[model samples]
Target: MEFSVSDLAVARGGLCVLEGVSFTLAPGAALILRGPNGIGKTTLLRTLAGLQPALAGRIGLPPEAMAYAAHADGLKATLTVTENLRFWAAIYGTGGVEAAITRMNLAALRDRMAANLSAGQKRRLGLARLLVSGRPVWMLDEPTVSLDAASVALFAEVVRGHLAAGGSALMATHIDLGLAEAQVLDLTPFRAKGQGQATARGFDEAFA
Candidate 1:
């Protein structure tokens, strides 16, 4: 499926930070969002994923069609690697838990509890959730955090496989995972001018 955003506006801490943002992500493609911190990448992604409403503009794709992965690993502390994947698989009504575990090199630690896993291991497990989601569109926020060089390469291969299978990924990150084919969208130009401080709770509340 093709995903698009046009003239989009989003707010954080009740303040408009991004406006006139536009982009299209086609099947089997990837788009990297580039911008400094506090530029509303997370806010825009949250709006697109349906966690929050867009202040203005349009999202061409339904939120249910996309699977979102945030910087924090959304894992159950008591659940093992395999258990976590199975839980997500059940909710998404998707199978292939075993394949996802293997693809992420988690077979060795499949039985280990999430709380027992290292930071990098937890990150790997979190990303594996994207595969079992079975959604064509992936909205990832800094998906490479806590990963070593070798592990980064491994995740890159997994992403390649997803694109090969006709899926799409939209990521906001600073690291280059060697995805030279993925297009970059710099968010600086679309920044909202003279935005106010976000006093209300939102993504930018910390900056208030």
Candidate 2:
């Protein structure tokens, strides 16, 4: 499968954040987004995931082909790890909870409650849902936030396995994910110019 973005523009709170962004990823490839904080990495990812509308351009992929993992873990604090996986599996109409658990190294913690797990473990559980999603494209935003060195390596292994199986990934992270062949997109140059300058137009007038 191939995923493409062309002349994309994203806005937050009705204010433009990024523009003129474009890229493409075929199966078995990965693209990493790099930029300083508030440069619209997360917004761009959200737009690509279809969580929000793009102000301009087109995305050449079916909405179902992409799965987004934002900064939030989205876990049910009251649910056990296994329960959480099963819940998402059923929602996505896919199964293989055992394989996902093993892939994410959550087998031992499968029965543990989400609220009781460490930050890294919880993040692992959150990422494990991606496998059950059965989507070809992964849109991740700072996916390694709470992971330690070992867990980071584990996550990389999981991503490698996905790519090997003909999946594509688009990730935004400040830390190195250890993917040697991944392409990088820096959003700094794409930031909307003169955004913070005082403009003659009011918010209501602009949106009107």
Candidate 3:
């Protein structure tokens, strides 16, 4: 499946931060979103994931086709690593938590509750969710946060496998995944004018 965004405008704190952004991800491809901090990367990913509305323009994919990973782990703190993967796998109807656990190197930590896991462990488990997501287009926000070098390499391999299997991804990250095939999209050109000027009364949320 192809994932695409065109002439997109997005807001954060009720103010437009990015506009006129456009890109397309073909099947088996990936795109990395890059810019200085506070450049609206989160807002843009949130908008693309339909967690927040886009201020304007178009995104070409159904909600079911995309799985989004936020900056946070989004884990069930009370659930064990295996349990967490099972929960998400059940939701996505993939029923393949074992593969995800092994893929993310969570097999050793599978029985540990999310709250007991270290930051990097939690991050690996979080990325593991995407394996069972069964969605072709991944919209990830800083997916490598909290990971050590080895874990990051593990993640890069997982992503590479996904693309090889004909999946696509859009990610916001500072770390280089050593993915030579992944293209970079700098959001600097799309920074909205008067972006920091938040209004006391702003336009209603826009979705598309």
Give the clash count for each candidate: 1, 0, 0
In model 2, where do residues sit more than 4 Å from their true spots? 197-208
lDDT of each: 0.90, 0.87, 0.89
Prediction 3 global C-alpha lDDT: 0.89
Residue pair clashes in candidate 2: none
Candidate 2, 54-106: lDDT as tens digits: 87889998988989999889899999999999999998999989999999899
RMSD of each: 2.3, 3.5, 2.6
Tens-digit lDDT track of model 3 for 140-202:
898998999999999999999999999998999999999877999999999999767874447
Q: What is the lDDT of residue 143 in candidate 3?
A: 93
Sliding window of 10 residues with minimal summed lDDT for model 3: 199-208
Off by over 4 Å in 3: 199-208
Model 3: lDDT of residue 194: 79
Report the CA-based lDDT of candidate 2 relative to the real structure. Answer: 0.87
Candidate 1, residue 52: lDDT: 76
Question: So what's the TM-score on candidate 3?
Answer: 0.94
